[model samples]
Target: MNKQTRPLLTLDQLWQFSLQYYSAREIKEACLHLQNHFHGNVNLLLTLKWLDEAQLTFAPQDWSTLTHSLTHIDALLRDYRDLRRKLKAQVSDALYKETLHFELQLEKQQQTALVNCINTLELNPCETPQLVEQYCLQLGAERLARIFIQPVQAHYHTP
Candidate 1:
């Protein structure tokens, strides 16, 4: 039998950490900027950074749920993104602005669902050495350029 792979933090655990860290206005701003402005995968970015915080190793297969990654919320995000773009031209419309705000709330709910989906897995604690590099590699060079905010360095690196 093939040995099944394990992940560092369960979806729920990862989400909990995300909520805690992102609760800070600055961190949340940075994550949102990377997600909105750059093409970086926000969930992966948040999860990867969280794993690094706990000093855990990166198990590639652990991300098997990657397929399920944004599937649940892709549509909502797409809609929100589209509306956000449209709102740029109609920024003065109160109704349009309110709609954007509603879409943003829906987007947040979708993210919450995404993080809650794979909550069963346990966090595999270890001394993760090159996880930051791995995350950077996954993010790719172009996206990383915008996503890699200065203070973000303190969060994603090995100790």
Candidate 2:
């Protein structure tokens, strides 16, 4: 609804543009055009353009599919997280002699699970701009930062 929340591109569209145009320049230009119209600022014109020309573009039909796909993915991720937490809660979960190795294995499992979750959402053309806009609204900038940063802080001590 708002200018800042527009979905300029979809995942599949991005891929197609990349394949057909051989670069994302045109898409980037479109984003910059939108930006100029909305904010009248040229500072982030290029970056906005690149984001606009990403490897995928969203579509109307893709919204339901994306919702379904993301729902399933979220469920699986939640289940995996619960399972890991339960495992950790078990006093006898790890072999006493293999504590070091077990910790390593758990860390690797968490990392692998996270990567898998991200990979599951790989950009596709079917994504709809409306869906992206909706997601952005739902998450907001600060929450988005937490979504990415919380995991890293919990596992990697990233500041």
lDDT of 1 at 19: 67
lDDT of 2 by residue, 1-159 (tens): 355653443444333433333223543353344333442112122212223334344344543443443343344444544555556656474543355455434434333333233333434553222332333334343322222222112322225
lDDT of 1 by residue, 46-116 (tens): 66566566665535775666436567677667777776777777677887778777875665665565445
TM-score of each: 0.58, 0.30
Candidate that would win on lDDT: 1
Superposed by TM-score, candidate 1 places the C-alpha of residue 113 at a distance from the truth, in angstroms, of: 3.2
* Winning candidate number (TM-score): 1
Show model 1 residue runs off by greater than 4 Å.
1-38, 91-93, 129-132, 142-159
Displacement of residue 51 (Cα, Å) in model 2 is 7.5
Q: How does model 1 fare in lDDT?
A: 0.58
